[model samples]
Target: MNASLSPLAILGIVAVYFAVLVLVSFLTSRNDSNNADFFLAGRKSPWLLVAIGMVGSSLSGVTFISIPGAVGAGGVNQAFSYMQVVMGYLLGYAFIALVLLPLYYRMGLTSIYEYLRSRIGPHAYKIGAFYFLLSRTIGSSFRLFLVAVVLQQFVAAPIGIPFAVTVASAILLIWLYTFRGGIKTIIVTDTLQTVCMLLAAGITVYYIAGALETDFSGMVRLIRQSDYSQWFFFEGGWSDPNNFFKQFLSGALITIVMTGLDQDMMQKNLSMPNFRDAQKNMLLFSIVLVFANLLFLCLGALLYIYAANVGLSLPASSDLLYPTIALINLPPVVGVLFVLGIVAAAYSSADSALTALTTSFCVDFLGMRETDVVPDTQAGTQVLEENTKRKRLLVHSGFSVLLFAVIMAFELINNTAVINSLFKAAGYTYGPLLGLFAFGLLTNFRVREEVRVGKVRIPALILVCLLSPIVSMVVDYYSAELLGGFQFGFLILAFNGLLTFVGLVTLSELGEPHGDDFTGTDYA
Candidate 1:
């Protein structure tokens, strides 16, 4: 099962992939071409499809390359330690289904950020949405940035194409397929992509196993008996990053903030019409993700064995390990699958994020509420619908350009293993969001509604949001010296939220509604 692995051949593969995605978009959006359809898939997506689609959207190309690399050499001796974090995600998803989903559904929110507006005031709402836009822009672009570098090395540079052109073309293909139907289109596209990525991984595993002269059952035994298969870090004590408690706790908190609290991740879940279906989707995704992640870890161990056996030198950066083997050292046909798998991973994530950013900006900043619409008359409704679509198009395009620029910037300076870097950055960016929602849901407290920028009033809660992460950073920087070399790892989120919670409590007066505080509507 081999094919041409030339740069031109890779380019053709990409074109066929885009063609399939575009066909899906056209079929999905043919009848209902409105803002609602663009933002939420017209609230008609099947739960199982959405669940399967989320696997690719969340893992992306970063996982395709980075997670395998992280098995150890590509990381800080991480080994099977990453699985501890997956266990934590189960707890986080449970919280999302039981607490967050009911609130969002009851509010009839098109964008979950609306819950911020209804619970806090306008400024806090914007702050929440602003954090989402900032966090996702950097995170999504970084994921794409990883894939772009691989494509440039393997497919573009040999053919004499510029890196920026390669980057632009990748983003453009995503935009072309996603511009019309938005999430409605992405629902099916992501499902197909999810299948492509997993199948590619399974096939790659089979090939590697055959090369090692082992069957599937034998391969499992080989992995289990090897040093690379080692899991847990009990002997490393509190200071070790791979300590089970630290990774597991961090995994849970990161899942809560990054997926449960995130607009891009939650948008797909909310697209389901009811809390029951959405809850099922979340539960299914949580379980599937655990098994799916194990496969990547297994693949990581195999890559190292293959490299050692064949006398291939591992690349300087562990992030390059998977790509180096798949694209260069393996069979040409395997190289082709590697390209498809990476692209499928990249688009699943990038497309979901692009749609989410546009949705949040249009609904949160532009004040295009789900409840705001034209009169019931046919003529008036037609004009309003047209205007909404036009505005949405502009927002979507603007964010796409912004994402392209950020990804280019990342290409210029990124030097770390991408999977670790992503989770580390998320610890800071998503910490404030975790705090805001925790204080809102757990306690009946209203923060000071208005603070001032000179003569201008802003959300008083902004001060707490700003202060929490700052203190968290200070703690993280000095944590080793301050706590006898105890590394915080991902648990920085918990410390950040605790600091935020205390700050909010300190500023409260403990009374009835103030001038402009939101105490959440009691809709029974």
Candidate 2:
């Protein structure tokens, strides 16, 4: 590792990157700067651009760093087995496009979880939305913290800045661009960031190939010939987390829950002009993701192969491998590009997440849709928009602080690979969400859709949703001892969802069978 470049160089790169994003934000926000625009890009975003930007958001900082590291680990982690999950994602995306999107579109929802409130009762609805807030806040904060650490380790600390300040600056910078244009700005800015990230990744691979005395075609051959390039793991059986069935199923379910069900991701999809456009975006994103993951895996294999040839010591933590090589071992230009790539990837997801949190909090919890009730009356709509802006701003800023707090907390205790850890936690929260949506779509039943049932009120349903995860967690802890050494892995999400569904059914009153019978679907 060189460790010779000045911290000033890195700070300059960060400044330039933020300038580009701010410029994009200014351009996007000029026409429409309100909550609808912020939340749904005014429902006018181009499908192709949304698709491209989504690829960036989906990749995020963890994929930027950790996917390659998985390859360096020389086990199932990066043996291309992750692709099984990626393949499973295609199924999940298709299900979302065909089934979930139509429902959200028909209802004309801003927050996808609002569908839950319509389907079950306010109790179930609040649980679903709150679960997303909990999951995404923790998930996005963890990502932002990772990038902050990278910046601190390589740039800020060397220049006498504290890690806390670095984290604050990063969040503040994202807040600057997103607080106005919101998802609209994100769609455009994420396109730019996505291009930069993918190009940086390709360039890093090319340089590593140069160091290995090989060209692009030869690099491909080298990866194909390496032991690390293997992509399947069928013989491991159900107990193996990387078992094909386990990984594939987990991947599909994760996609359906995380991307399809998640407002941060789905908000962009819904921003498109119509269902056709949204479907196009989903299909394109799903296809491009297959190749994207393939590229990352190949880069990982190349990094390890290059390390062996150069006799560079592998970092103890695999996540450190990509940054160590790019910033120190590789050329200075590669280091500059790596910083931008990481910042772009991290902020791409983080910005949208902050916006979604704000939207959910305002629309779901605070009841800001009172003005939206008079869309046909322009004067009434403007008044609603004016009032909504103040509330939206407050919620957005509040989440910014909440994100900072959670990230600082994560800085205290986080040690695992964030990508894996995030998904595991999501399994608990998103599990209930998945069940809530699945039960709504898959069956023709109804729970008390109001805030209370006579003596059987909101907390009872909330309690059921809450306890479902705890029960699932216990069953997961003792799975091996009690169930013939079965390992649940990501399949734990399915178990958690099953528990919630049964609970919902148990609480429900029998109803007349009808098509998509949700209460308050007319609210939107």
Candidate 3:
């Protein structure tokens, strides 16, 4: 394959892109670098910018490359079947807007896990936040790993840089821009990154059309005539991963758990001034996300069609197909767009994850309330604020290092398409969250936080949360044998949540339900 851009050129593009983000960070954080500004952008973010920025953060590099590649991979998400999942996302987003958003705003929460504490017990609260921390860490690490592999293959490796340095450098760059401004800076930068990502996908589709010697309508016709154009799968039965009902239900549950129950995604929504504005952001984001995913699936079909027409051999990993063509097979302009798009995708998600992780840790673990102010003179308040800011900075830096380490670990073990691995991991890590929230919202029973077992008082909520996923995993592994070829697929989230709800029920007693205003004490 002939290379269109040298390693230096690609590196230059990435540097210029991050320089713009750094400028945005400086401008956004210059006046206010306090915790409020860092965490929720002082609740002054525009709904539209938050909506647009979320498109990039939610899609990430996983969607950019994996979704398109999955379209033609002919196993999971074959052809337009992924659209069924997108359609399910609409239902999930509607639930979030109508149900979850109002509940969150009613509680006036900085961290959504606070809802668990107020409604259930302190053990439930800590357990909820722990699951989110685990989920987002693994999710963001997988995303960053995708971009690192691309860079190592196309840019860093050619220049004799090791993959670890490439990964470390990428994380460091994200940390530098995000450490001060936090989500406040991310709101603006993510909007810019969203544009870069969409443009890259659109342009690649256009160029592939030109190479196929077809116009826009003709390209559509070609895709329609192709084998990859089939969208719905009704006859595949329960075991087929691409079955319509399976994909649609999984899509809705995944969105609810990954977005509504997630800190990284919800932090952006919560940054808006009111729940109404946040609801608007969620609705608009869902609409735009549907179209964005459709565009990617179309691009995937065209890529495979183009490869076949040119007799180009497919890569070993489907995730590499987009970068392989964009860098070595297409024009230099497309190569540049690929670099910008991947970097934009990577930073958009990683920066927000880092901010949300820090936000959750400080608010949920360290007991730092967003509304807490030193009850003293102006000078004393400033001193306390400065001290709080130092703690936040340290936490933010710590998570960045953690992310780098996780990505390195992923490089050693990851063998499947990242999108698959991501959702599979989410099914386990996010299942407890789904279950905890479901129990709180849907049931009137109050759980006993501690259950006595043979003179040992155990945290029932934590044990339940941990065991739900393990049980779900065991059930999933032997599902075919036990259920006569019925596979759980992404529906594992729902099952895991159900197990948690049942466990919580066992720990509950018949009593008056807790009020919405209940704020339980932390256990010793």
Quote each prediction's TM-score: 0.95, 0.94, 0.97
Candidate 3 local lDDT, 1-524, one digit each (tens) = 34547888788888899899999999999998888788889888899999999999989999998988888887888899999999999999999999998888777778999999888878888889999999999999999999899889888988899999999999999999999998899999999999999999999998998888899999999999988999999998988999999999999999999999998899888888888899889989999999999999999999999989999999988898899998878887888898899999899899899999999999989987665577878888888888888899999999999999999999999878898889889999999998899988988898875878799989888888989999999999999999999999888988998999899998888786562355422211
Most lDDT-accurate candidate: 3
- Those runs of model 2 whose alpha carbons end farther than 4 Å from true positions after fitting are 1-4, 74-76, 370-384, 448-459, 513-524
Question: Candidate 3, overall lDDT?
Answer: 0.89
User: For residues 228-346, what per-residue lDDT tens digits would candidate 1 score against the true structure?
Assistant: 88777778887888888888888889888888899998888878878789999998988888888889889999988888889989888787888888877778767778888999988
Off by over 4 Å in 3: 1-4, 515-524
| Reference-based lDDT, residue 377, model 3 | 88
Cα shift from native, residue 199, model 2 (Å): 0.7
By the lDDT metric, which is better: model 2 or model 3?
A: 3
Error of 1 at 383 (Å): 1.9
Cα distance off (Å), candidate 3, residue 219: 0.8
| 417-447 per-residue lDDT for model 2 (tens digits) | 8777777888988888888887788777876
